[model samples]
Target: MPRQHITTHIAILGCVCLGLLAYLFHLDQPVSVYAGTTSTAQDFDSPGSVSVVVNKQRPLGDPGYVPAVLIETGGISLRQEAAEAFAQMARDAEASGVAITAVSGFRTAESQARLHDAYTGRYGTEVAESISALPGQSEHQTGLAVDIGASGGECSLKACFEGTAPGAWAAANAQRYGFIIRYPAGAEHITGYAYEPWHLRYVGPDAAGKIHGAGITLEEYAGLYEPPSAPPSSAPGKNAVEPVP
Candidate 1:
């Protein structure tokens, strides 16, 4: 082969290698990390991220993960950012004559385990899994979830709450303040839980607004709603339950 031809071939090969490297680098990046994607606000995989998606299929990175800072709001504890947003939302609700109260928030993994155990004992593993979340899989452990209730405690945690003033108001307005109804009615298949009208998950105003506007769960919004490759196992003597929101 001519010397010039050999050099030209080598140059072409180098360019091809560079192009391949560039293509691989792009592939390694998260598609959602780019602007205009469904989730562009924050990291969805980090346990401490406001946009983190914690479902039965997607447990927290650390089973014992806790928020860096928690603040009390309406007698419940939430991460500082979530608490602040809730306070604002509460004030707004009260101003509108719809008093919102936080009945439960910021449960630890241990606390979740206790609740799960109690529910399992009463309802059996199958029913309990639908009503309650397992340890590490519960968003309440992230200090970004708050169970809202009426100030008068009417229909507090039951399905009836969705009809109450507080619940109705929050359903319509919580997204404006950076919260979403974590488990919506008729979405049990996607969220893995029954309708929890009182449960609100803070995902920042941007994400909350987008999710609310789209009428989808965080799992769907973050692209984590697919079935796991392997089914999750339960404790000895307990039947494996489906994933919960």
Candidate 2:
């Protein structure tokens, strides 16, 4: 080979090698610090984010009353999957003689607006803002949340069902049937809602059990199931004791 040609080939090969090294270096770079702050379709673990968007498709059927005891009621109408899981839970609870009822379900955007307005009117916007999620942002909008209580209005969550027979029973058993307490009594900061013992979510048994066993929030579980590229922000209160449920 000609000397000049050999020199040119060597130069080209060096350039290619340098390019490959640069590419590898880029891939090895630390993950971005701002990963979870923005929305991205990649977050499959966060089913709530995907399901909460406003739409005409109400999962739980047209606005109507479902057997409350059978399901925890929430602002969103119950979705079919959620309703089914709740029914199973009700049956389980009934087997033990506790009658659970749903106090609320499926709130349309308009309904959420009214509810928020009502609470804000009474509690003031700032306080209500902390307690009440904005319409689209609410988990209730997904029709996956159920608020449970004793048959009579006499016992709201304040009844301490978490320790009572039914509450304790449900906590111990809900995971087997695909229902998980979405928020626990002391996990308010992680869940961004006050401790709502009555509220449960349907993430299926395996996930529910894992979360329940972990004693963390769905937010944290979702974060762990699909961790962000960067380190996590300080969680709301203390780190959640367990995941969802």
Candidate 3:
């Protein structure tokens, strides 16, 4: 082969190598780090696990499942792991001058049915579904979800609670304790629920961090639902700070 031809081939090979290196670098980017992230190093496929996702599209892993251990906090109960986190978060919020309290947690499937029926009866099926979960399809059934309010009872179980001090504090700090606002505003399309600032789901701190940092719902973090190209503009009730979770 001619020397000039051989030199050209070598140059082309060098360019190809550089291109491959660039591609690899792109793959190593921080956002690419999420390729390895799913409910904090665990995917959402395990219904019996802490990372399980319960929603309209999915139900608890086992219909008859109940937490092996349930702990109470302020008259509400959560699974052991979640209860601890819940207590810690409330304490931290109180230290910060925000008194938060849990209003509901660890519901039986039968209880969920009664609540759903009541809501459906009063408000119709559509409104009931937006706020209440069907029996086996509730995260509360997993003992990992809790609805909270201010200690003073300000805005209890109401969207206006977001404007309350306790609500503000939880919105900012819930992720630190392995919780996320399950139904964030503007994400109703993806979450199949309305914006409920008080509904918190504990998926573990590791998973919660990724979900909070990414400004996505658990379903989105789990690769279960794809957000729209342009998300709708739904203003979070009153105080809109920390709208991600």
lDDT of 2: 0.60
How well is each residue in 70-157 modelled by candidate 2, as lDDT tens digits? 3333323577777777777778789878767776655555676688899899989876765556665555656666666766654465
Q: Rank the candidates by TM-score, best first.
A: 1, 3, 2
* Candidate 1's TM-score: 0.77
* Displacement of the residue 16 alpha carbon in candidate 2, Å: 43
TM-score of 3: 0.76
Q: Which one is best on lDDT?
A: 1
Give the lDDT of residue 52 in candidate 1.
85
Worst 10 residues of 2 by lDDT: 50-59
State each model's C-alpha RMSD to the native: 11.6, 14.2, 11.8
* Candidate 2 residue 239 C-alpha distance from true site, Å: 32
